[model samples]
Target: MTKNNAKAYWKENLRYLFILLSIWFIVSFGAGILLKDTLNHISIGGFKLGFWFAQQGAIYVFVILIFVYVRLMNKLDKKYGFDN
Candidate 1:
């Protein structure tokens, strides 16, 4: 790719990276810590949402996000002709 195209690709990739990382942080730390009490009022399967998120839900979400990020990166790589 030309320098301009490469620069554009990197800019776009950085945007996506920031968005994904922000979400990861929000779900793992924000919901699990900052908003834990506020979320406790809501419940699923007899477990308080906040507590659940803090203890288990966040971990599950983190795992799923990892796979989702991998899939997204794979697609992005293919689309940008960066895949091996």
Candidate 2:
């Protein structure tokens, strides 16, 4: 890739990475601990929201985020002419 294209590609990649990571962190740390009591007021399938996130919800979200990242990066790669 050309210098400008490479720079653009990396910039977009980092932006996506940062956003996804921020979501993961908030779900795992904030919902699971910092905001646990608040979230616990809500329930899902008879389980407390906070407890679910601490045990399983975060893992589910993380897996979804991985798929999201891959899909987004594929589009980005195509846009930047980096895809095969």
Candidate 3:
């Protein structure tokens, strides 16, 4: 790839990484700790959102995020002609 195109690809990858990490932090730490009480007002299947996040939801989200990142990165690599 040309220099400009390579720079653009790296920029896009960094942007996605930042966005995904931000969401992960929000779900794991923000919702689980900082906003726990506020979220507790609402419940799902007898479990409070905040409590669920702290106890189990964060782990699940992390797993899903890993898969999502892998899928997105694969697509990005292919699009940028970086895939083998």
Native-referenced Cα lDDT, model 1: 0.84
Model 1 weakest 10-residue run by lDDT: 1-10
- lDDT per residue, candidate 2, 7-35, as tens digits? 99999999999999999999999999899
Give the total clashing residue pairs for model 3: 0
* lDDT for each candidate structure: 0.84, 0.95, 0.93
Worst 10 residues of 2 by lDDT: 27-36
Maximum-lDDT candidate:
2
Report the lDDT of model 1 for residue 66. Answer: 77
* Count of clashes, each model: 0, 0, 0
For model 1 the TM-score comes to 0.85
Between candidates 2 and 3, the lDDT winner: 2
lDDT of 1 by residue, 1-84 (tens): 678767877887788789888988888688889998999889899899888988898888889877887898788778778887
Give model 1's clash tally. 0
